[model samples]
Target chain A: MTKKKQPEPAETGATEHQLWEVFTQPGGGKPFEHAGSVHAPDAEMALQNARDVYARRGEAVNLWVVPSSAIVASTPEDIGPFFDPGNDKPYRHPQFYKVPRGIKV
Target chain B: MLGHRLSEWCGHGPILEEDIALTNIALDLVGEANLLLGRAATAENAGRDADALAFLRDVREYRNALIVELPKGDFGFTVARQFLFSVYALHQWEALSTSADDDLAGIAAKALKETRYHVRHSAEWLVRLGDGTDESHGRVQDALDELWRFTGELFLTDDVEQALVKQKLAVDSSSLFDAWKRDVTDVISRATLRMPGDVYMQRGGRSGMHTEHLGVMLAEMQVLPRTYPGAKW
Candidate 1:
């Protein structure tokens, strides 16, 4: 089995700082959405950096930082087959049904 | 006053990310100054508006901390000074948030949130710079030592602050010294930095007797207003 990459030491002098993807909740019951990224030594620093970088404008009430390396991403080559099928499946959408009006049901 | 100081770092920060960060911090300070100065204008009730009070004030009439007005030094010095000031400002804002004057309290409440972020940013930089490399450590240490003298001025309470405290409009500045020291020492220890020994503290910013730096800064800051009276944007 292949070995997983390890995080660098969280010391200030550490040479390798990790990149963290920032997610922010805009409040009012909205879900967290991807904001941007910040470079920090650890989770604590990453959260603080995210606040300084992404929430400077009061645009977010909550923030989450995830290691960029931990994200499993699919490339553009997979887009055609991986996500295109949803375009042809319009029947799954609620708008696809035509309700017979006049009755409450 | 703080906005101008922070603006000095606008294009001069060591890196792009930090440049933006410093500018943002400057903007936050400027906003806070606007709120506080607005209150000052209304309280004076001498027919001066915020703009007139801000732009027309003589050098000796200004009341910002001497530390904030000091020239922006090297990156290490800048961050060190910022960290030190933010520590004190955080406590000041915290106390001000509970003031009897609703307007002051409201402004302080908003400023407190921003100041919290400023403290975190500067404190982190202090640790990184203080422990990063030998050269960085030495430079940041020098910054801490040099800026320490100006710190006492932050907690000095003169007649104005005392009056405000009695009126429930302001916190006694001296009361913040212990908490400020605890916070500063904690960060210094974490950064592996040494606290400078107590020295003769600088004074006079509160009483309007400022260093020469304020004179040069005011010349540039007031140039526009003096050059063109009642000019609108």
Candidate 2:
């Protein structure tokens, strides 16, 4: 007797690994700025993965890759009301100060 | 000594990608060596700073791993040495990032980023050479076999490590060994290269003993500062 055969599942995209957030410094004098994210198997691989994904065009002088899980981030929705209180502080604005001619702020 | 040996690849590498990678790695190592030697100088109360330790010190006085002092032979050999050392360094830095000594932890935090890249770059090269072709594969395998002996000293426990570990300024070298072995094995497996088995381990870099390659390297590296003494830009 012939039985119905089970079909194999179709192949999917590359397996998703842990996510790592990348930060990069463009040059010696520059501050390290957040770049983007990459997927990798481990920290060592995450570093290389970030290099290929973020620094391909010599855009980085340094790089930092930390597991996304390791980072504690504030959500925009949660912080919006918390940050709005500071917006009413007009005294915090530097525009209130007058500087001499040829002086840069 | 570490800077001198690393600087040998400043302009000479098999490819442009590799040349830049090696030089960048060298620069990072030099930077770390400067920081460490500066701390060592301060600890010794020698009234010497990083420059004095880096430039004025005689060959016999330098304390760096012999693996770092060995010359960059071919691309394969360079990659093999880098692969081993970077894995060891990465583990060291990872552990040191939590060190009770704030300065050491800070240095480890910064240096860890660079060491991570160094490990990846070399591991990639190892895989490439190992899996490329018959000739390339054979050469890389040979390089690994030759360089394997020197790796033992990387984890050799001694007074410095013990003292530093007690002070919480350094990680225990013995603890790092298993992680390092696992990393290298994974890379080797991916590279299709067989790990050299049952080889005699070379020792004596932590105590200032080194291969003959170090002397020539020191001569060139120390020349500018030794000749001028106090010259500055």
Candidate 3:
């Protein structure tokens, strides 16, 4: 609640319209993936616009709409400290475990 | 026919994003037309293929609603026409999804989801235009009044629809009117726009009677196909 409204970059060439990021899940059990973004004034319109722009080809069975302003994003400068810790921890990966000789693996 | 009408606004929407959006909708409708006409070609048992049915049909043979055949007036007019038509289409498709004909039911099931988005898109625009500034409100109000007469044709049924409905292969369009009215009234009220008065509505699209606009549109649409009969890329 205390977070400031995030400023959207003008990369979409729609500086005036409110930006909404669209995420779509292709089918049941499928992970939601970033589809695209749309410009709309409100959430309802955003969802509709997202459907028009993203899911026209039956590409999605589920959709999620988030206002660009409400999103909390990390900057490029945060890559080193914010992400590197996870990268160096090999034991955290499932592939790190060695298979026993008797097991199918 | 709807694709052609919508395609007229291809590069002419109020904004770039909206322009592409309208074109995308046009393409979607064209895709549906392809499916329906393909079915009609075989269902009619005529020697004609889908292309022939589409490109060779006279204006009198068209089964589309008059509302879709009407000329595009302005942004307000386009939005109003689309809002009304989309609502009708949503209901029609919803009912058709359960059709006894598997092909039609499959098509309708797919189309229902698309029309759902179309309804939301057009309904949102109607509200925006109707509740906008004084100029916008006036423009959309005038559009609604002008377009209202053609809407009756959407609910008009004929022998063809009756036969199909009896077979559970088509939706009963007449039954959809009450729900359509209620829904339209609700949307209009949300937009702070008044519903048009009960007046004698223009009709006759079901049986192929149409305004001159369809002829002009047909002429343009059929030109390329007619000119090069067997040409394909």
Candidate 4:
């Protein structure tokens, strides 16, 4: 919900209008998970394309189509600083402390 | 049938996303036909099943509207035909959802959901193509112009539908024209396209009289069933 689309990414080709990242909620109360992607001119078509490409045969009860440009993913340059710092510290994992039963850390 | 015609676009849509989308709608329509024809067979109290009615019968015995039988001319034409038919079908299904016949009402209820999506999908494409660049705009307009004549047959009601209407067993398709027109007019205008004028409206799919194209299509569709008896899909 927080992601906002960035405009005029040069990679968008002549025939391509936009690329959308599809997310699906498997059931009520479930979190939306990244499903796949589709190319459409706008959000309306993106949503429908998600349904057509992913929702056939009752795959999901709900759908969300986010513009791929909206997502801010970590680049390769950030791999060492963003991820490696966490791996050296085992106490960051919940197993180091008393945890509620059935709770996933 | 329109379903078969739509299915032909399975691997041939202009874009990959659209290709999958169009074929999904085609499958929905094909499923609708299977259910409707199965019910028709039961209603007739004849030994014939859906397979026999669909594969064994000649084109002359078909009762579908002429618009569905015409060739899928282009991407624009396909979307235009879907928009035209889905709007009408939505209305018809709405009326049928309250039918006195329980089975038909159930089928209508299920079909109504599918039809809503069909209407949305086609209407979106129509707007995109019609309001698009010169080439897209011109092509869609031409397609719409060519398909306008076939719209009249969709609302035609004969004695079969009339008898069922009186008994609350069928929808009065003729009565649905006004709403269809209103909805279609709004979408066409929104698409930045002019409505085709009242030219000569083609009719007669109800009587099984079709253009020369149907026979050719039927040959391809029915060949397997006609040659290899008792073939199952």
DockQ of each: 0.17, 0.04, 0.16, 0.34
Per-model CA lDDT versus the true structure: 0.86, 0.79, 0.85, 0.89
Comparing 1 with 4 on TM-score, the higher-scoring candidate is: 4
**Per-residue lDDT tens digits of candidate 4, residues B137-228?**
78888988999999998888889889988999998888999999999999999998999999988998899888888888899889999999
Give the TM-score comparing model 4 with the true structure, all chains together. 0.92
| Residue-by-residue lDDT tens digits, candidate 2, B32-119 | 8877777777777968898988877676777777777887777788778888888999999999899997877888999998888788
lDDT of 2: 0.79
Clashes of each: 0, 0, 0, 0
Error of 3 at B192 (Å): 1.0
Candidate 3 residues lying further than 4 Å off, grouped into runs, are: A1-15, A25-36, A72-105, B165-172
Local error of candidate 1 at residue B139 (angstroms): 1.6
Candidates ranked by TM-score: 4, 1, 3, 2
TM-score of 2: 0.70
lDDT head-to-head 1 vs 4, winner: 4
Q: Which is superior by TM-score, 2 or 3?
A: 3
Best by DockQ: 4
Best by TM-score: 4
Instruction: State the lDDT of candidate 1 residue by residue for B1-233, as single tens digits.
Output: 76787899888876545777889899998889888889988988988888888789998898877888888889998899889988898999999999999999999999998899899999988988777767778889999999999999998888877888899989998999999999999999888889999999998888888999998988988889889998898
Instruction: State every prediction's TM-score relative to the real structure.
Output: 0.84, 0.70, 0.80, 0.92
For candidate 4, the C-alpha RMSD (Å) to the true structure equals 5.3
TM-score of chain B of 2: 0.94
Sorted on lDDT, highest at the top, how do the candidates line up? Answer: 4, 1, 3, 2
Question: lDDT by residue for model 4 over A1-105, one digit each (tens)?
Answer: 112233343645455768999998889889988999999989999999999998887778999999998999999999999999889898998767888899886
Q: Candidate 4, which segments miss by more than 4 Å at Cα?
A: A1-13, A98-105
